[model samples]
Target: MAIKTWELDSNFKNEIAAMPGGEGIMKCFQCSTCTVGCPITELEPSYNPRKIIQMSLLGMKKEVLESEEIWLCAVCQTCSERCPQDVRISDLMGAIRRIAEKEAEEGKIELKGVRAIFEKAFMHQLEKFGRMYEIGLSMEYYKKAHGGFFAGMMAMQKDYQKLGMRFFKKGKMGPKSMFPDKIKRTGEVKKIFEKVGE
Candidate 1:
């Protein structure tokens, strides 16, 4: 068995350090507090904040940016909360996500499905009733992603079924429940993203 080595660029660290909240990645001392604090790790074995920081520190940009683990993060803030160095690990992950998106647009990366799912799911909510309608968004997301089998199966869970029927019966599709005023900000958010690229 042989271990393959990735050609890490020397400038990668400097580039990542320039992103917002990225400076703390360099200060991490491998205390493992972050890994212990992350609830996602309990569910998803691949979701390790410590390894992510290590990769970032080593300038493994390709691995860090292309990982589904980054997007799967629940943004629970526990990693930062438990850090002995007070590093903002969650924000660092967010910076990596932004960089990944930029890399994707430039043809340097190909994480299209991740962006597509997120955008379509988000836009469906924005266009329909303003903020997220859990049932509607999940249904639309599944229809587009998995052809509804997975979503349908998940919806069959007792709690999910109860919630789904309640929402369906209540028909919570209005201004008060979904925040109609927030609908106008969708374009603004899009424009902000546009400027971020420019």
Candidate 2:
């Protein structure tokens, strides 16, 4: 579909550049270095960092914000390491995601995938325990992903039954794993979350 003229927001790039890790966005010069080095691009041809940057520079605000391509970046930083202009493409992707998330939260747009859900679940576990709690993380992920506790449990069982059994046999997961003691510095962890307004 062709983009309408009014859909463009000339200030969009500047808005992103103002965000942390986004300051280098304008340094990009359409060099394909980032795209060339992007592991995701090799696996998924539709995920083009160079194209995303060019769109952003061209003020394709809505397209860039709502595109699933932004979420495909794995943040492995190969692109950042290879960028001759030091665009920090991995960090740039993160800045874009942050904006997308903000827009989603404000009801301005809908996110199309489970990545945001999984991220919230993961962060909730981290914030609560000051470290990862796999059982809790799994439960939370399924609950949000599938919509409820019972449904999540059923889905989890169907998906992980064999793996769960193996983990149990290897003492990797069990009843005791369900209620791990929170880390000693959990308060410190909460403070960090507070500082970030998470």
Candidate 3:
């Protein structure tokens, strides 16, 4: 990929530091501790939280916000726990996620592919039902991800059938879960979401 010219916006690091989980980002000094401890790196060699942080610090706004790698973070705190500088790499990832979502929402950039849809669908399900509806989230995300409900269903048919059979045999799959279940204090849950503006 061609590198984008860095713009005059050198405030990315400071902006991230001001975010809720990003306070420790400024203390990093190219230490590799975070990368060495991040389990995601073992699974996906292309994803390195350290590299992502360096990109943000270097003011690579477009690359930082648009790369699917940012969304790949599992939010496991291994990186933060292992960091010698206490940069809180997981928290920095959260800050980057917030910025990316904001940029997409504001039309500063277009979010292509399934990651954005999946995140929104997951959040919507969580907010509405106060819990995860796996089937519902899958349906919603795949519909948007595949650009059509039918395509999504077709693609996920086998996996759904397999999991469905397993759950049914184990007596775990039930109609109640297929339907969205609201907790006793769903209102309170909604309020919490409102407070967080999620």
- Encode model 1's per-residue lDDT on 1-198: one tens digit a residue: 122355675566677679987778778998899888678998887888898887777767787788888787677898888798987888887777878878887989766344456555766665655566665666566666655666655644533667756775788544455433456557765665457532
TM-score of 2: 0.93
Candidate lDDT (C-alpha), each: 0.71, 0.89, 0.83
How many residue pairs clash per model?
Answer: 0, 0, 0
Global CA lDDT computed for model 2: 0.89
- Ordered by lDDT, highest first, the candidates read 2, 3, 1
Residue pairs in clash, model 2: none
Q: Backbone clash tally for model 3?
A: 0
Candidate 3: residue 82 Cα off by (Å)? 0.5
lDDT of 3 by residue, 32-102 (tens): 88888778899998988888888888888877888888888888789888888988888888888888889
TM-score-based ranking, best first?
2, 3, 1
User: What TM-score, to 2 decimals, does candidate 3 have?
Assistant: 0.90
Candidate 1 TM-score over all chains jointly: 0.69
How many times do residue backbones clash in model 2?
A: 0
- lDDT at position 87, candidate 2: 87
Model 2, 140-169: lDDT tens digits are: 999888989999999989999899899989
